[model samples]
Target: MRLLVTGANGQLGHAIDAALEAKDAPAAYVDCVVDWVDLPDLDISSASAVDAWFVAHEPYDVVVNCAAFTNVDGCEADFAAAFSANALGPMNLARACATGDAALVHVSTDYVFPGTEPGERLETDVPAPISAYGRSKLAGEGLALAANHRTHVVRTAWLYGEGKNFVRTMLRIGEGRDEVTVVDDQLGNPTSAADLAHEILRIALTDDYGVWHCTNEGICSWADLAEAAYEIAGVNCRVRRCSSADWKRMNPQSADRPAFSALKNGHLESTIGNQMRPWREALEDYLR
Candidate 1:
């Protein structure tokens, strides 16, 4: 199988690379020729550039699109860049895949839903995005599924691993500060990029295609996650909990986020018998 992975330098992309490199998981990626591409080499937002690359490469069995414009506040300010990367980019790849009869695994986010309810969201749940970033991603999801027959949308939340994410930020801040303030009202899973990557690969291995929610099992507030990180790191720091409103009020530039965006991994577990580890367990392993 010939596999093409975009956003090769991102957290999830790096985790996929690590998974492919593991000798113990030879069967996972065996007989697969993978090509990793990003920015300078391939601009997914440009249809012409994307088409040219597809033509040059000829055929690909699978295209895992991890590339996205993830800046929520930035998206509010610059809708063009956000729509180009998050929405149009996936459409280009999906169209290309449709032409080549290839499967598409598009990475999405739980932000697509307006998080007002307290329960975990299912794949069947209606999406009512509130922010520009969420709308862009929702648009991408629709286009991807509609453009390609073999498209799969994987929605995840609260991701961190070996990159600029919450866990790393907390660890870094703990080094210099005696206390950290985090939002206690906003709730979601703290998924490790590695775990999400592994799950993506497993999905790629199958021909079944649809929307799937993949994240570390348990859910918690940002404050809980920060406290867990400090505890695991053995950092002597106090984590002060504040409401999401307070957090945003304190940081005027902070983007609007879902208050309860926890996703239920129903389809993935039902279809593949694969469920992610709990958030705390994944965090412990990641910190170690």
Candidate 2:
């Protein structure tokens, strides 16, 4: 199979590469020819560029889109860039794949939902994005699904691996600090990129084409995640839990986040049997 992975240098993209390289990679990936591209290599946001690339390298069996404008605050400041990357990028890929047999696996975030409702969000839940970033992603999701029938929209939350992320920030702060303040109101699953990559591969192998919530099994607040990271890494740091309002007060320019955006892997559970571990277990494995 010929596979295309965009945003090849990002955390989730790197994790997918690692998974394919691992000894335990699925048999389907054993004979797969993978193409990794990012920024200079290929701008997925450009429809002409995407079409040209697809024409140059025809017959891609799978296209995993990990590219996204993930800066939440930056999205609020510049919605155009966010829409171009997050929404238009996926649409371009979907349109390209529409002419072929490639199944598009678009990675999205739980932020698509308004966190005001306190519960684990199901794939069937109606999305009401609050911030520009969320709105862009939601648009991407819709466009991808509409453009291609073989599209899998996988929504995840609080992912961290092989890049600048919350866990890394906590670890860096803990190296010298005795305490760190974290928001306790915002709740979501802290997913490991490795785990998410594994699941994405599994989902790609099947014909289950629709929205799928693929997050770690458990949920927690930002403060809880920070504490867990410090504990797992054996760092001597105390977590000073604060409300979301407190965090917003300190960082006024920050985009508004969902209060409870935990996603339930209902589709995965029903279709392929959810293999995701608990959030803490995944975090421990990642830290190790």
Candidate 3:
């Protein structure tokens, strides 16, 4: 099946690109190769550009939309840009899919839940996003979920990979500095973008058609994940735990963050049987 992966330069999309050709990857994910398209070639934020590309490409079996406006603080500062990239981008892609009779697997986030309480966020749980970024992403999910009626939204969290994540950030701080500080109050699973990409492929192929939550099996605060990172990387650093309020005080946020927003993957497991590896294991593999 021909597949198109958006945001091919991003960690998750690039991982998916590599996994399609990896011999060690699961048989189901190995053979199906994808055509990776980066920003200018297929930027979903530009409807005309995306529509033109769709007209040219004709039909794609799966369009895995990994593209997102992911800067939480930036999103709050610039809601228009966030909505354009996060919400309208998916909407445009979903429209393209409808035009070409294609399927879509839109990746979403766990931030859609309002962090009013502490617990697991089930697939059936009603979303009450607390931040501009989260609200924009939730809008993206809603558009993609409703656009084609055949699309699936895979909500995930705490993504880390080769670069540009909390894990890597902690690794850098631990290696470069004597000590580091991370917020302990916020908790969620550390999802590997590579695993998430493969899971996206699984959902795209299967008959499961709706919003489903997927993430690594365990939970951890930023402090916990950072500590695990330092331990796995064998880097020595004193990690001090602090509250979200303190974190915000140090690094003022444009958006309100969810204190605890772990995704539950029971639906995806039952339907596709491609649950991601444990966060610890994935983190170890990533660090190595």
What TM-score do all the candidates reach, one by one? 0.97, 0.98, 0.95
Q: Which of the numbered candidates is closest to the native, going by highest lDDT?
A: 2
> On a 0 to 100 scale, what is the lDDT of residue 178 in model 1?
85
For all predictions, the C-alpha RMSD in Å is: 1.2, 0.8, 1.6
With a 3 Å backbone cut-off (N, CA, C), the pairs that clash in candidate 3 are none
Q: What local distance difference test score does each model get? A: 0.91, 0.95, 0.84
Clashes of each: 0, 0, 0
Which is the better candidate, 2 or 3, if ranked by lDDT? Answer: 2
Model 3 off-target regions past 4 Å?
24-33
List, residue by residue over 185-283, the lDDT tens digit for candidate 1. 889988999899888988887888889999999889999999999999898889998998898789887778999999999898789875689899999
lDDT of 3 by residue, 50-88 (tens): 898887874787888889988899999999999999999
- For residue 260, model 1's alpha carbon misses the true position, in angstroms, by 0.6
Candidate 2 residue spans exceeding 4 A from truth: none
